[model samples]
Target: MPGFLLNLNSVVICSHGGQAKPTVPNPRVRVMGMPVTTLGPPYVVAGCANPPPPVNVGPCVIGNWVLAALRVKVMGLPVLLQDSQAICVPTGTPLTVVLTQMRVKGM
Candidate 1:
């Protein structure tokens, strides 16, 4: 189980790393059918399926930059902000979040 946890952690890290530097240009992220702009480097929030369309989705970032940018100055990086000011997304729709910036700890 410990090994599984470690692997899972690694999987999460790798996933974040890939998202931090997406090679695909103009990656479209939608929720509940509406388009949204995320705060960070385009991270898909887990388990936010079937969101209302045309919603503003914020991405999770490490203080506006990925851990790669932290260098050695910061002892460790903080987790990305998972929640933001809630916007009214109409029910029964998927929202689209277009990532514009990196989601940092604080807005």
Candidate 2:
């Protein structure tokens, strides 16, 4: 858990939305390297498959970067954010490093 919680909800006032034009990239906290036991099954919301593709798949839910980012950070550095759910990660603590560390420990 991080000491601070980041609110992704923002209003940029763009002429268009979607990952085009401004195309503000959503920084995805890498969970690809996390331990399998903790990663949990592919998160499925509103009956949609985990990480549903970008398409008009009817009204449904999808991955929440804010939440995922928090999870990744917490799993990587539980000590850093002892009493928090999520906050921006410290400089240089990338997801790859965290997953590598955990995997090494497991082996």
Candidate 3:
């Protein structure tokens, strides 16, 4: 199993009058080297401190194998598939990974 190191941050905003409120600083949820299975719905996990991570609400199953797909929220996202076996993303980028759940047909 492979894992990723993520740098995260939490923020809070308060509204007043007719203008938008400022953001309040909170503790960052640094999910360093956490399993991809832990990243899911109801609880969002992303890469950067700027743009939020993409939403993943589905399974990533193919044939009889389950494949994982990571949504990276960054500029010019580049993906490299090594030896047609593994896929990789660069560093200094924020990513939200999703693991596939298996449900074989006629099992």
lDDT (10s digit) by residue, model 1, range 27-88: 24322332323333333333333323355333232222232222211223222222321221
Ranking by TM-score: 2, 1, 3
Candidate 2 residue lDDT tens string, 76-106: 5321111211211111111111112211111
- The sequence of per-residue lDDT tens digits that candidate 3 reaches over residues 3-78 is 2322222121111111111122112221332121212112222222232235422221111101222443222221
List the lowest-lDDT window of 10 residues for candidate 2.
Answer: 13-22
- The TM-score obtained by model 2 is 0.18
Model 1 segments beyond 4 Å from truth? 1-41, 54-69, 73-107
Candidate 2 stretches with Cα past 4 Å from truth are: 1-42, 47-57, 66-72, 77-107
Clash pairs, candidate 3, are: 47-94
Better of 2 and 3 by lDDT: 2
**Residue-level lDDT for 3 in candidate 1:** 10
